[model samples]
Target: MTKPTEIKALVFDVFGTVVDWRSGVAREAAAFLQRHAPHLDAFEFADIWRREYSPAMEEIRSGRRPYVRLDVLHRENLVKVLKRSGITGATDAEIDELNLAWHRLDPWPDSVPALNRLKRRFIIAPLSNGNIRLMVDMAKRAGLPWDAILGAEVVRAYKPSPQVYSETVDILGLAPAELCLVAAHNGDLAAARRLGLSTAFVVRPTEHGPDQKTDLNAQQAWDFVVDDLNELASQLDASID
Candidate 1:
């Protein structure tokens, strides 16, 4: 193992990393469809909606469009997806309600307990691209014990950008080395590492479900690569004390 650094807090990526957004969102969408459009194939529709996520974000990242919240992106794509799948007659109120499904995503089986352990030792918070409202709602819904919530919405920038990470550390009144970025995504860890923050990779192989194709394992030598957050907590506790 690499020599541990003076880490005092661990900020995490929420969607797909801490929570099983793909499966949970798909399940919720399916239930909504079954109740509203019984003849529609909810599973297929869910997959279609998810497939649009990256491209939608890319448009903003590439400067082809202005930045929009994930909720807006999800709703825009949902409308097209529902229409393409021949589902009709849904009212605006119903569509608005459906857009909130992301907020109710379920955490991975080990997430809550692992987070609980980690929280006992260090300041634990979510540093995700999700807006504050979305993060707060999700935390409440999933029983996530976050000490504070930080996100792109608060800083008006997203991950892989040094500003968001730096801002988070500054706000927490900690130096870069005093903070660790715990995420399942290598790209996110790489960004944090570049900005002098310690990194921990917690693998979530099935984050994209059975058809998952990326982030199967840690791609770089992070400060720590533990099996899960619980193990991560143990490792950190042993290292610092």
Candidate 2:
């Protein structure tokens, strides 16, 4: 395990790590669909809509398209998914409301208490691919107490780019070793580790639901592996004491 000696701040991945995005988005989409398009299969629609995320991101990453925020990507994908599912009559205004669904996701049950504990010892913030406005709005709506919000929009690059991770440290006025990237996704940790940042893997095994195909566990020897955010806080507190 890497020593936490210089670590002064902890950055977290918001979706599926700190927050239950899948379930939260699913619930909201379902409610909206039932209210508006009663004939549509909300559950199937939600799942299909989320399934489009990776491909959409890939398009941007490959330079086949211009870079767009996750919120815009989600909205574009949602339109296609809704149309494919035979649900019609969605106005542009309604689509805009649905796009904001990502902004209102609920944090995991343990997130608040755990973050509060960590906040007492270190500067805690979100280091996510989400844009600044999205992260700020989500934090506000979900009651996530973050000292600051860092996102790809600030650096104009996404995670796995050393620039983004390094820039975050620079902005925080901390050394690379002085910040830990806490995330449920191993790919995210891998990126941070390669860039000399401390890493913590908090397992969110059910994050993708029963059909989970990736990130079952920490794939590398991360600095720490814990059951949840609460456990992560306990370990950090113990280290300090």
Candidate 3:
């Protein structure tokens, strides 16, 4: 562990880490289908949308495309998945509203309180790949209490890209060692480690729903491996109710 004195800030990965995107999107997708495609499975729709996530980011990662906001990619992904679902009669306006589901996700049970506890002791913010608007909206909706919103949009790069990690530390006016990257994804942590940042791995075994074979457990002996945000706070000597 990088002793508590070493880390002055904690940056998080959102989506499955801080917010329960699968369940949140499922809830919205279910209502969407009930009114449109009564036969389509809603949770499956959410999973399919999520399945497109990494690959969509890869397009930018590979320079096959320019840096597009995640909001745009999500909307494009929704259109493609809807066609596969075989549900029709949805207007563009309805599509736009549903596309905002990412902005309305609910936080994991301990996210808000744990963040509040951690915030008292360190600068806390999200280092998500989501655009600024997406993270801002989600924080307001999920009550995440982030000190700042940063990541892909700010740096015009996504996670695992050394740019995002390096630039985020720069933006916070902190050295790489002064900020801890707290995430459920080992790959995200690994990337941060390369930049000399501290790392905390919090297990979200069901982050990918059942059968999530990867990131179900820590791959390396990271600086901190706790059960969840609450425990992470406690481990850092932050008071958590």
Which one is best on lDDT? 3
Pairs with steric clashes in candidate 3? none
41-100: candidate 2 lDDT, tens digit per residue: 655666788889778877766668877788888888988987787777878988898888
Kindly give the stretch of ten consecutive residues in candidate 2 with the minimal lDDT sum: 36-45
Q: For candidate 1, give the lDDT of residue 30.
A: 76
Cα lDDT tens digits, model 3, 134-220, are 999998877889988989999998778899999988899998998999999999999999999999999998877887887888998
Ranking by TM-score: 3, 2, 1
What would the TM-scores of all predictions be?
0.91, 0.93, 0.96
lDDT of 1 at 212: 74
Error of 2 at 126 (Å): 0.7
Candidate 1 lDDT over 1-241, as tens digits, reads 3356477888999887799887777777776788767776655666788888778877876668877787888899999987887778888988888889888889988889989988987899999988888999999989999999887787777676788899999999998988999999999999998888889999888887777789888899888897778888888778877
lDDT of all predictions: 0.84, 0.85, 0.90
Per-candidate clashes, comma-separated: 0, 0, 0
lDDT of 1 at 142: 92
Which pairs clash inside model 2? none
Clashing pairs in 1: none
- The parts of candidate 2 lying over 4 Å away from their true place are 35-41
Candidate 2 local Cα displacement, residue 104, angstroms: 0.8
Query: How does candidate 3 score on lDDT?
Result: 0.90
